[model samples]
Target: MAETGTAPSVLYEERSQRLLDQVALKETDRTPFVFATRFWAAKYAGITFEEQMYDAEKSAAALEKVLVLLEPDGYVPSLYIFGPTLSALDYRLMQWPGHGTDRNATFQYLDREYMPAKDYDEYLFDPTGYCFRKYLPRVAGAFEGLAGMPDFPSLSEWRFVGAMRAFGRPELRESLRRLLEIGERAEEAAQKSVAFVKRMAALGFPSAGGGFCKAPYDHVSDFLRGSKGCMLDLFRNKDKLLEAIDKVGELLLRGVVEETRAGGTPYVFIPLHWGLDGFMSPQHFQTFYWPGLRKVMLRLIEHDLIPVVLWEGDCTSRLELIGDIPRGKAVYWFEKTDLVRAKSVLGDTVCLRGNVPTSMLIAASPDEVDEYCKMLITKVGKGGGFILDGAASIPDEARTENVLAMAKSVRKYAS
Candidate 1:
């Protein structure tokens, strides 16, 4: 790999520290640039999206090309899912390239309600039971047999013998057999992901996020109930839904804390999907979204982990409400929200990242891209806490010259 400053190890340290300093609201020598992307690497490197998912080494090769050319301070890895791993579980949550969409197309999620509103009480009372018996079967075909199994929590002494009979069912036995295959594929995928990160480190590019998580409301609205079901529950099942959110929020926090600790990286990525202005009223956001999200962030901070939140849609109306946090402990990355206004509202409280229009990146001239980046650097990066990135992330169709211009402008103006 070509050296960034002098040597690979030395450059890695410098880049990692630059990101951490920006997170802490400290002025850096220059504003850090993080290339957050998914399929852009594959498209840029002349590989199909299917190749990026099914071939680990090829995906890394594609990502290496981008890192060598752009040399951003850090990057969100371009390859995350392994197709074979999902195939093992017969996962139904998303339809990936070559599976549901065209080989060159990006993965698409199916947003049907996996958990109906009537099951809220059961989930609140025994989430483990609900996941195994109710939730798993709905989302993954591999777990259809699990639906027949009795709740283990109620088993004891003589009751245990009856539970064993449930496992003896042919379908349940087949599910257990399939689980072994899933476990093997999952372990292989985990190792490849670890190796991929290590390879990026050796190339002198630190990953922008160490771990991943989501707000409790998003977890529910996204996976459990569909957006429509969850929204209607606000009026029909308020008490039960609130109870379930707290239970799931605590579980998510514990799991993420453990994962981040094991990964030994300071930044935890939390993508907020349901908290945008178009999703709910301000009162509903205050009641259902921010409190649970704030709890998760505070818990992460207590453990010395920084929560990097991506507000995916326009959240311009909710900026002030979102700023009630300890300064220098988090980052709020915006997708469509006005960055200049965000900087004014949250400049002193948290690190700011992104708002580059993806449309501009895909269609505008390189000079137009450079001008936009210059404006962002001069206005938002005027203060200490800022990092340059795409609005959501680098679009799959973004022009190479436009991205190069973004990277170039950062050094030209911020440095």
Candidate 2:
């Protein structure tokens, strides 16, 4: 890889050294820090979600704002930009079939499907103008409710919001063309994507996305198809469901892994499920949701990539089933997960992060943030395997001071 020269590289190396310490299971200059955010940053910039999404300057400025405020030991930008920036020309083609709540694909989730019509599977491979009618309104309007709401995620997006804000209609169109075309056109797109990303690595962020894995159920519901279809396939033609994931899993993971490798990311994100807790029981998660992801995670770490699984929805109740994850090859980002049990089952093998209440950032005092963060560090930050993040992305409802204080205190006290 050609080195991105000067200060950015210098800062990257500096941060890398600290993260490297954590990865090695040794004490770093300080505890390693990591947080995924956009809402928090947008609030600081005084810009709407629209401004942040289409304007790069606003995105970066907002990022700088977060850096200035929280100054955490680690960071990961939100995924709001990639689809909009790299695929803008085909934004109409690339479907984001997310409901307000669905972020993971299926194995185990709630008793709902964002796209109940997924059983048709007609939309999976077809690219028709008709599908655009239903998809576009939701895609553009996902944040429409937030148009008047303060600190919308779209407004603060650097590539999506920032770029659109700065560029003329023609320039925006050309950039999108450069970004959307696959292979050579895709090559150009990836390069432009890399430029912004390299800037981040150069600006001192530790890179890792090769390990990006979320529950496929969310993917099922949002992108290719939805849970309603997948679940039906699972029950009616179990073999077909298995075979389909076997093929799709490789393709989805290969791109995420390759992108992370391309960007030189070390730690990648994985959210696991088949739906334990309120959604489904532990047995179901292991059989349907996790087996496929388990294969994916195994392959990821086999290549020396570290997997950070965001175990959403009360995964604390189901660790015994999932505990077999390759130890020391990954860390757990526990959301609504039980940390004590996680530490018992996962502490020795994998690193652990999170479990702080999302509501804490919105309503808790700084002392409360500090106390909760301090508690997590005390419980999980031992032996150098933990990094601090939230059970979920710190939301717009979270108080800025509380969020900043959470990061500050976690870094200050985490082992």
Candidate 3:
């Protein structure tokens, strides 16, 4: 790998400390640069996305090449789906690696009402049991037999012995065999992910996040109920929906705390999905989205993990609700929200990252990128607690010169 701009001996520590300092609302020598690109890494390494997913070593090498080229202080090393494994299991949530879509197209989630509206009570009563017995079978064809299988506790009951016979059947055995194959392939992909993370850390770019979480409303909307179903639940099944939301929120917080406790890294990535302005009115957002999400943030903060909130869409109207967090305890990465207004509303309470138009990165010249970065750093990076990043992600087709300009500008202006 090419020499990182920071010294090799202290590079990782230096970059990590820079990010931590900004998270703490302390000024650093320069603004820390975080790049969000997944497929672009594959593109940078001159490989198709499918190749990156199947070949662990190749994927790691591709990420390393991108890091060496862009030299961002931090990045997500891998955001790939194990397409072959998912395909093997006949998983229906997403289509990837040209299986059901174009080879060059990014993976698409085939969202549907995986959980029927009628099952709300069942899901609320036992989320784990419902997921295993109800949801999984619907999504993964290999698990269809699982739906008929008795719940584990029922196995101990004398009357349920008949249900146990299903597991011994040839079809169920074949499904189990297919599942094992999927698990093995998933393990391989996970190993590649670990390798890529280690490679990035060794090269001085630490991961921007230590762990991840989803908003409770999104957990219901994206996975269980479809978007339309979730919206309808807000009115039709208000009480049960609220109960389900709280249950999910509790589960999420518990998992995040347990997973992140020993890592020693403070940041947990919380991608805000389906909570933007267009998704719900301000009052509904206040009612359905913010309460559970805020509970999660506060709990994470209590455990000393900084909640890095990636606001995925227009949240301009909900800034006040977000800004309610304790000062310097969160990092808001905005997509379509106005940065200057965000700064005015949230500057004191949280660190801000974001909103460089992806179009600019793909179409603008290097000089143009430089100018835009200058404006962002000068305006938003005025005080401590600002990170420079693309508004969302660096597209696969983003110009290398423009991306480099973003990194170099931080060095030139902010340094």
Candidate 4:
């Protein structure tokens, strides 16, 4: 390890300067550093995945520990604010009642016994106080817990899934009300989460952590809401589906953008919920994903916030589809994606971030991680668009040697 210490003022200044230069779409003295870390945070801190999700204090501690240790060229990662996290422990709870925080980590559709006939104004989504009125109390409650240790249920409480909750209406409206209530709570949770992030941003190291961004298929796939249902709705009620997506983006991004600008953080996060390869093909990506993404990015840009998308799963198949995005608009947190080709294609447009194997991090020695990262820095960092980062969270169980290797390799090379 590079002596777990705080990055010196010189290093911090140089990183910020270089990153700002990149943001301007210009060359810089050094390539910016980005951390695609998630579970790795808790692990590096000697904690468990369940604890990171459930305990805000532990999550913050881990984040700070990593920041102090690595002191990368840039501090940027998404704030994971889901209702309940999907830990292995939480997933098993699904078999019981309200919802599990472990086991399946998937959303199993609850058969709602009843529902409102599209008329309950206060309970329903109201344009004015809709966000605060419905969710503020829950936010207040969570804030208290987090004031101690709050958590949002991104999972099905009964299941161990991670996603938004707009799809799959149940047979009975009554039972559905609980889900709806959870949705309301989610909205409230998202709003408060943004505020909490803003507070964190102000309190600690300079960073770019923002609100939530879950997709339709994400909910369907993880929650077991049925992809067929969502795809069918795309054809049956395109406007509604579109509206739902827009609502989610607005709820999650808008507040964070405002807070980010006010907080003076240079970057913004767009955490994609669906997988890169399976959710929908490139053609379908254009039809559904692109338009919403364009609007979300555009809106945030209007507020002078930089959007760095966390593209998950194997998106190698969709590289060409993604390359169409305008250059300098965003940086991708690419997960398990093919790099050589991504650099060749997308390099001309957006800033490409990562693709290190998480499995290798868990199994390999420091030498392996070092060799791989060194090659990546040399190869991808060629034209000035690459950002050093893990393709996904360096798995919690990753060998400590692997983490050290990746870090040393990144700082070792002088661009």
Ranked by lDDT, top first: 1, 3, 2, 4
Q: Tell me the tens digit of each residue's lDDT in model 2 across 1-415.
A: 1223546557577667766566555655555566676456666677655445545566666776676466555677552434344233333323332322222211122334333344335334432322343443334323222222222333554655654443454533453344334335444445544565566665666543434666655455445445556556556756545555665566667677676676677777776554657555465566667777777778878877777777777865667777677656777678887776787786777777776688887888878888888877776777676777777767656787777777676547746
Candidate 1 lDDT over residue span 91-111, tens digit each: 899999998889999898888
Candidate 4's clash total is 39
**How accurate locally, in lDDT, is each candidate?**
0.87, 0.59, 0.81, 0.57
Best by lDDT: 1
- TM-score leaderboard ranking: 1, 3, 2, 4
The residue-by-residue lDDT of candidate 4 on 345-376, one tens digit each, is: 88777777776788888887788787888777
Alpha carbon lDDT at 191, candidate 3:
70
- The better-scoring model by TM-score among 1 and 3 is 1
> Candidate 4, overall lDDT?
0.57
> Distance (Å) between predicted and true CA of 398, model 3?
1.0
Off by over 4 Å in 4: 1-7, 23-25, 49-59, 76-205, 211-228, 246-253
Error of 4 at 53 (Å): 4.7
Write candidate 3's Cα lDDT for 172-196 as tens digits: 6777888888889898776767666
Instruction: Give the TM-score (vs. native) of candidate 3.
Output: 0.94
Clashing pairs in 1: none
Best of the two (2, 3) by lDDT: 3
